[model samples]
Target: MEHRYLGNSGLKISEITYGNWLTHGSQVENDTASKCVHAALDAGISTFDTADVYANTVAEQVLGDALKGQRRESLEIFTKVYFPTGPKGHNDTGLSRKHMMESIDGSLRRLGTDYVDLYQAHRYDYETPLEETMQAFADIVRAGKALYIGVSEWNADQLRAAHHLAKDLGIQLVSNQPQYNMLWRVIEERVVPTSKELGISQIVWSPIAQGALTGKYKPGQPVPAGSRATDEDGGGAESIRSRYLHDDKLTAVANLEPIAAELGITMAQLAIAWVLANDNVATALVGASRPEQIASNAEAAGVTLDTGVLSRIDDVLGDLPETDPNKTQSPATRLT
Candidate 1:
């Protein structure tokens, strides 16, 4: 797998990061999750991204157990704070000092690690003051619990404010994780430019639009059995159904199949490569339920799509992509 520096920071991560979001401890069995983790490691993916909120903290335990024997220094493990975890108490969520301080300890205990390579704010905490949040992160860094800091789905203005605060607090705010793909270009207009100026890189999630860009979900056909669209409980079925399940989007996605065929790669690879074409994107986060799925998606690490190919892809997708920068936002209020 190809490796790139996460931001202006010296830390480097795999271009294709293995993320266990909707799979481990929720959608897939533990044995299957472990096998997928092993597949990622075998494919040279050393970066694993998970959140404490995923499966109500079971995902971290599953990932830690899966990665038990390898050299710790050889891997970069990441977890997030915010979102209610552990009994969902009043103080169990958000980026307050108490919640962050307690959440880091819980995350470490579950991940079976003393320190994480990166600790990210899963979303902007509207309830907590930004100063309290940054101070908590600075403390975490000083305590050696996390080496770098990041955020997910934060808008351009929010990123600028946080970057400044993190700088003043003497912490490295290095990355922003957002939903980025061929069909979702919300980060391109404002977030990318602002992040590039701030020296923060993007570790994008759902690079295939939750498998819609993989050409597996046909335009007018029933979603294949067991696919993300068919899964209702823990499989992000609502997200896929509400976002890109329409025939207009599916038909546009299908038009890109020939581009993948021409490149001798799968539609998934084409989608991933398109995300990586942006210089500000350091890595594309991918999740898998099966071992071979990880192996196949990892092949997109070093693939390059030239300007012509990218343009053709744009032509095929043609305005179906969401490019409005305003769409990149966090919740107006913390979820209970």
Candidate 2:
């Protein structure tokens, strides 16, 4: 896979990062997850993204086992904090210093690693002071637990404040992870500009809009069996339905079939390539329960989309994409 520098940092990561969010320890068996991770490595993917809260921390354990034999220096491992993982308690979650300290130790123990390449805040902690959160991150870096820091789904204002604090604390905050796809452009308006100005690149997740852009969920058809839309666990179906399962969105996605055929790529590849077309996007994150899925999606890396193809995508998905700057919101209370 092609690699790029994450923001202005010297660290280089694969353009296509394999992520285990809902699949590793929840949707798929451990053996299946291992196969998928192997497939990613075979495809030359050197970056892996996971979170401590994913599958109640089972995902990290499964990923660590899957990556056990590889040369750790050759791979970039990323995980996040700011979510409840252990038994519910006042200090069990959020980005407070106590929670971050406890969480990083637990994450390292579960991931079987002494240090992670990047540690991110899963969300902006409205309850914790920004200074406390950034200072804790600085301490994590100073302690050699994580090399760099990042934030996920943070608004432009939140990012600016954190970036300033990170600079003041001598922390290298190099990336921001956001939900960016052909169907979701919420990051394009303000977050992208602010992050770019702050020397931070974006590691975007859900480039396929949870498989809606793949045209697998046909408009007006029954939800496909075995698809995330049909998954009963983890509110998967409900989440997709609320955002991308609408008839209008599905129909718009279907209209891109000929475009994908003309380009000799799958709809999924087309969607991923579209996200990578942005210069500020350092990587596009993809999650899979099966090995073949990673093999196919990895091809999107280094595959450049021409201007006409991009225009066609915009024409088809016109006005359906959410670009509201105000949509980048954090929960008032920490998520359980």
Candidate 3:
């Protein structure tokens, strides 16, 4: 896989990162997850992204086991904090010092690692002081618990404040993880510019818009049997509906089939390549339940879309993509 420096940091990560969000513990069996992880490694993917809250912390354990026996230095493992992993308690959530300190230890124990390459704040903590949160992150770095720090789904202002604080604290905040895809351009308006000015690159998720851009969900057909849209218990179907499951969006996506055919790639690869076309995007994160999915996505690592194909994509998906800066919102209360 192709690799790129994460923002201005010296650390280099794969252009296609394998992420285990809904699949590791909740959607697939452990053996299946291991196969997928092996497939990623076989495809030369060196970066893996997970979160402590994924599947109530079981995802980390599964990923840890799957990654066993590889040279740790050859891989970059990233995990996040800020979501409640245990019972509801005053100190169980948020980016408070107590929670941040305790969460790192728990994540290390579960991941079977002494230190993570990157530790990210899963969301902006509205309840905690930014100073307290950043100070805790600085401490984590000083204690050698994590090497670099990042944030996910943070607004431009929130990212600027944290970036400034990280600089003052002598910490390297190098990346911001956001939902960026052909169908979702919310990060393009303000977040991308602010991040560029701050020397931060983006590790984007859901590049296929939860499989909608793959043209698997037809415009007026029943939801595909094994697709994410049909898996109500997985808790991702609703977001897919609100984002790209409508007839208008599906029809737009279907119009891209000829384009993908002309390019001699799958619609998924076309979508992933589109995301990677942005210079500020360091990596495009993909999650999979099966090994073949990773293989297909890894093909998009070094692929480039021509100007005409990109224009065709924009023409087909015109005005359907969400690009408003105000859409980058954090929850008023900490998510449990």
Candidate 4:
């Protein structure tokens, strides 16, 4: 497998990272999570990404139990904080120092780790002062509770502010996590350029666009059993993720099939390979329910897309509307 330096952090990571977003927590059994994690490790993927709020709190435990007996130093653990893990309250979540401090502890306990290789603020908290959030993260770094600090879903301005804050305070903010894929290029307009300029690497989530790029769902096919698209629950469960099923750009997926067929690869491989193809991407956080899925996802790490194929891909879907038609907006040409 190929490896890349995580931004300018001096940390080298596998291009593919196993993630437990929809598969762990309560969506799949512990045994399944274990199989996925080990399969990823065996396939040479060395990083895992999880968030505090995934599965309402069980994702981390599932990961921790899965990693048992594995060489801790051989793998990297990344977890995010900021989303509410409990009922809404002023102190229940966000990047406030109070919440940041407690959230790290809770995450460590659940992951069964003493230190996270990277601890991220899920996003900018408009209600909390940036200074408080930076200072809290600095403390976490100083205390050796976290090896590095980062943020997710943060805007370009927020990223600039955090970079300077960390520089002045002598702390390192290593990477930014964002949702980036052929199906979603919003980050490319601003976030990707900023991260590239700031020397911060981007670890992309939903790198597969929640399986939309997998090409398993035909436009009118019934949602598959045990698939996230059919779920009814909304608390970070597979059901909760079905909202993406309504995504506007999924029509774009159909355009790539002929190309995927030409490459003798599944749409899934083509989509994942597209992410890895970008030099700006550091690691792709992949999700899965079975061991084979992890293995399949990892193989994409080596699929190279030449210039012509990339150009064809761009010509097909690069002009998708900004607001995600499945979510809120219309085609770009009609937008005022």
Candidate 3 lDDT over 188-246, as tens digits, reads 88999999999999999999998999999998899888889877886598899888889
Across 1-336, the per-residue lDDT of candidate 1 in tens digits comes to 999999899999999999999989888899999999999999999999999999999999999999999899999999999999989999999999999999999999999999999999999999899999999999999999999999999999999999999999999999999999988899998999999999999999999999999889998899999888988887889989889999999998888888999999999999999999999999999999889999999999999999999899889888888888999999998888
Span of 10 residues, lowest total lDDT, candidate 1? 226-235
lDDT (Cα, tens digit) per residue for candidate 4, span 123-176: 777777889999999999999999889888777777899999998889888798
CA displacement after TM-score superposition, residue 170 of candidate 4 (Å): 0.7
Better of 3 and 4 by TM-score: 3
For each candidate in turn, give its C-alpha RMSD to the true structure in angstroms.
Answer: 0.7, 0.9, 0.9, 5.0
Report the alpha-carbon TM-score of model 2 versus the true structure: 0.98
Residue 303 miss distance in model 4 (angstroms): 1.6
Query: Best-fitting candidate, measured by lDDT?
Result: 1
> In candidate 3, how many Å is residue 211 off?
0.7
Question: Which clashing pairs does model 1 show?
Answer: none
Better of 2 and 4 by TM-score: 2
After superposing candidate 2 on the true structure, give the runs of residues whose Cα lies further than 4 Å from its correct spot.
none
* lDDT of candidate 2 over 1-336, digit per residue (tens): 899999889999999999999898988999999999999999999999999999999999999999999999999999999988878677888999999999899889889999999999999999999999999999999999999999999999999999999999999999999999998899888999998899999999999989999999988999888888877788378879889999999999999999999989999999999999999999999998889999999999999998988998899989999888888787889976
TM-score of each: 0.99, 0.98, 0.98, 0.90
